[model samples]
Target: MTQPNTLPQVQPSTTAIHAGYTPSGDYRPLTVPLYSSAAYEFGSHAEAVEKFALRASGFTYSRTGNPTVSVFEQRAAALEGGANAVATATGQAAVALSLLALTQGPKHIIASSQLYGGTVDLLTDSFNDFGIRITFVDPDQPAAWEAAIEEDTRAFFLESVTNPLSTLPDLPALAEVAHRHNIPVVVDNTLATPANFKPLAYGADIVVHSATKALAGHGQVLGGVVVDSGTFDFSDEARWPQIARARERYAGTSLLARYAGGAYSMLVRSKFLHDLGPTLPAANAHSIITGIETLPVRTAAAQSTLLLLANFLEAHPLVKAVHHPSRTTHRHHERAAKFFPRGTGSVLAVELHDADLVPAFIDNLKIIALAANIGDTRTMIAHPATMTHCRLTPSQLAEAGLNAGVLRISVGLEDPADLIRDLDRALAAAEVSGDKSTVKDVVFA
Candidate 1:
């Protein structure tokens, strides 16, 4: 038999720098060339017609795809072990497009109660307005997920490692339930980058990311990606009408029959993304590409710093709880060990004993910036109740396990000792201003 042709597999770092692009012709550029043109010129009207009809593969419009964004998509897909990917303007758009493509009004989705406040808002408000119902379930309870599934349930959504808390979901258990009912599992792998935790390997059918966080590894650019594993069968017209139903525009050929394995992703691009239009600018895409090159190194360094901070905070007097699985006392400690042996991606939530000290604690931080971002080279902090999750109602905050006193810290590549010192000084200042009765000498493990 003739040898099956396969590209030699490279490691994650190698794939990040080289997978999606190749230098060609004289004066070959070292990086992906930014094709800034709004539209690609076609040789003839026939060729343009063919491209527009989805029968041909070529960049006809920037709104649909771009060279720089295509490179980001390809590189992201390779990293996640996915077949195809689409990059969006923000991670929120990626999340919206992923679910919108799967189902529409009158269908149902079972989502984890432990989710970013923004996501909860989208599902609870916007999606509700669109007539799609969502059921929030406790991710740790496998039975709850199974029980919540309805006849019109189209998808199961959850984060690989939860925002702020770093709590892990039972992906295998959740996927089993969703797959048993022919529903897809969509995971937001933002907090835990693919370098540390690839949701696809844990039975996720589709993976989404907020590239502004860990994938970019820098706080400069804003982007998101939706990756399709291409393993799930969407051939059942009865379930996934968007992909499996034949359309008059495609000459009665269904998207699944035409694109085969890539049906779901093609529909995402051609349908929702094309119309809604959250295109990642080519320049921004180029910057995100640069960020991805050092993903492996950046992830490891930041994760190490995070673990150190988490340990120190867990032992502090003013801290009531540290919500990261790296700690032995954490509820999901064993789950972290099983799913994330490398490390949980570097974001943790600390609940202070005195919620009144939050403003002072935030004010005293010298090195850490009080910002709403994660997975960057510079460490930052976020207040869930007052910042990211401020829009959520009291009931919603309780569902996500966030409270007024919880502060989310994202560790960067800074020296662990310096970060620890900053934290100590901040806590000390807050303690002196708010409560002195329980203040004690600082200690770290």
Candidate 2:
């Protein structure tokens, strides 16, 4: 077996293209190849015993690991500057596995208030029913995070760039707060994918990705990944009582001692993935792997185009406000400049003067597609108040800045001029009927 190499300090654009493929022998494939088998043949009973007992490493099932997924995991791990990664079925599954691996009943987690609605619903509602108590804080305030942590707090969660609103939190400060309490910090790096920001490099303990977004670079496949920085000392018995308790439950030693840097990832694989069964199929893994190859190029183009479009939209007469991290009006501008100075990423939101015009605006657009999914090669847009954030209550929607007049734009790899032209025509058509007060009330409810 080959020892894993220590991650080098490398540029993200370079890492995106070349981190994972360590080819051996005469395959000489240009792209990462997929391994389609469901199971692996054991060489002997001893080999099988070692694999089962974790005495040695090998793929036992494609649901857990396969060549295509391994390459994807390796590449993602390298991009996030983590020790290892486990690819899963969706971003929600990735979030579930990361938290569930370290916790069971009666655990506590501190999470950001400005999070994806699905995540808010998961933690505040469903996970709470399962005995996980969550404390929500404004990620904008680092002190709120420190104050929210309890003795039982196992993890602190935040998004690198918050969905829809485009808020960027102070990662280093948040990590410091979590580390002071000897807890791990897991940052959802979906919006700012490693091409723009690597949370682990800024002291985040673990990074989760919704690979369905920019990493996949297309809306065709759905997948997620959890990368372990392997920096936290999980076996420090005084700090991690759960790990100590876990050692007692199983015949194995403390996870830190048994698996070293890979303890969390291993637990996630053997326990969460195995029991929950949110495993990505081999075919989906193959498609996501192919999509990842051009991740850097597509994201770069998208970021640039979004900024240009934001500037145009901000000046347009029909638009009430523009919400992009790079915009001076954004509340999170300072944090965005520090963390994602290259760009605020491709997603932004526009609040219109009248909500009635939203449908007309969307339907009038020629170049951009009106769809719920984002980060595709083709530009897509959505009315989050009516679609993605529909589950949220009026007060909750207002808290997330997802009121009736708001519309989200997921810019794609398209000519900025053509996009602006299409949006110009659409905005004109949307406002042609004039401002209507009836559109101001809650459309989502």
Cand. 1 TM to true fold:
0.95
**lDDT per residue, candidate 1, 95-160, as tens digits?**
999999886756999999889888988999999999999999999998999999899999999999
lDDT of each: 0.87, 0.81
For all predicted structures, in order, the TM-scores are 0.95, 0.93
Encode model 2's per-residue lDDT on 1-445: one tens digit a residue.
1122343677767666666765454766656666778898999999988887767888877777777778778889988888899999998899988987766756899988777777888887889888999988888788989988887889999999888888888889999888988889999999888888889989899999888888888788899999999878786766565454456533556666677788789888877887778987777777887787788788889988998899999998778999987888888787787778777667899988777787788888998988887778889998887777767777677667677878889999888999999999988877785535444564553
Positional deviation of residue 124's Cα in model 2 after best superposition, in angstroms: 2.1
> Judged by lDDT against the true structure, how good is candidate 1?
0.87
Pairs of colliding residues, candidate 1: none
lDDT score for residue 59 of model 1: 85
In model 2, what is the error at residue 228, expressed in angstroms? Answer: 0.8
- Candidate 2: segments with Cα more than 4 A from true spot: 1-9, 238-242, 245-250, 434-445
Best by lDDT: 1
